[model samples]
Target chain A: MFNAIQHYRLVQRNRNRAGLGSWHFEWIYKFFLHTGTSRRKYLVEVRQYDEHLYTVDFYAKVHNVNRYRLRTHQHAAGKLGATVLAIIARTIQQDPQACFGFIAAAMLTETTDENTRRFQLYTRMLELKINPARYKVEAFAENSTIFVLPHGLVSQPDALQNTITRYDQIFREVF
Target chain B: MTKYSAKSSKKADPRQQAREERKARNRAIAPERIAKVHIMADGRKLLELKPVQIPGYTYAF
Candidate 1:
């Protein structure tokens, strides 16, 4: 399926096309992929980990896609780490008590140290076993919070705002 | 005339079916062992850079 959130390759088209503003909370959690008769949900946090992969849940049907360009000379086709994570938090708030919880926070520690520091905020606060330079799994299921660290990462206000709007619209439409 | 019935083969071991389903579910969560990235350039502008593996939480690839 040619889905916006492509990693999960969720077939939500035609007979299953996402309704208008279907990206919202209530409608999304209804799927077997997100809710699936569980009391836990997943979240994402991305850092400037690399170019293509931002950070996401391996099993879950959503992958972070960067919309904003990095400050460097690299193309911006990758998932905007921060905004993707924010969308994840919105997805989790959908139920707060029904889905099996997992978090997909990531950082690109390979290209910059700033991402490493931002991620440390969560690791130090939540005491997560973070080894950005060494972590490879794109899915983790332990902490209540996730962070994204990126190398040569630059903050984008528009991306952050758009992410929030996506969540807000999702909340309004679904609930 | 002998009637052939599909119901005779309809019964499956529920436990085994459940196990298989669980296996399928677990398989979905696996991450790509190797994440690949390619940066394309068009003149002075870099065209693309994206990770070819799953996003977020990092585990042993």
Candidate 2:
């Protein structure tokens, strides 16, 4: 069932090089989603906050003549969601103890309602794809932020809660 | 019962009512302020970064 969701290949770039200086991301992954007619470019950045905590940020763009522009086309929403899920799965596999926090910001839309819609879309995707046994998912719908913590940490409730609190505070400050 | 009285007796669908309430609740929650960094120079710099080439690589999901 998971493989049924079509996604483009994610290409890793600059493993050792520094990421965006201002953001301090450790790694950047790039992928192009082919929508039958045109291909959209996407960049996924992973920023490590602590030993096992990280945040993922991604955006899509289209090459317009010479420069790239933000792609606002909504037709590829399914593929976009699938690609992000694949990235998260890959990240967790690489580091079993890794906890991820991210925001479903309405980058393309202007209205607050669109932000809510985007948050709902991301929450739904996470619910459908992420396994409940291995990970504990907590979402702040009002803030459009989500944290996925490893279920192994449930044995240490204090540590888990602290991590969530720290990440929430960081998200509020950084984003 | 009279036609007007019978029409007035009809109740709203519980599922539909719940959905409307959910929508209102969602709308009431203010969205977080998202930084417009993508349109800025930092975002473009990411696009400028050169992509590494891999031999015999094929696109897969």
What does the interface RMSD come to for each candidate?
14.6, 15.6
**Tens digits of per-residue lDDT for model 1 on A128-156?**
22223422112122222232323222134
Native-referenced Cα lDDT, model 1: 0.29
For model 2, the local distance difference test gives 0.58
- Which candidate comes out best when scored by TM-score? 2
Clashing pairs in 2: none
Model 2, stretches more than 4 Å misplaced?
A1-25, A62-71, A107-115, A154-156, B1-22, B25-61
- Candidate whose DockQ is highest: 2
lDDT of 2 by residue, A12-83 (tens): 444435543323335667777676687767777777665588888777654443121244564777776666
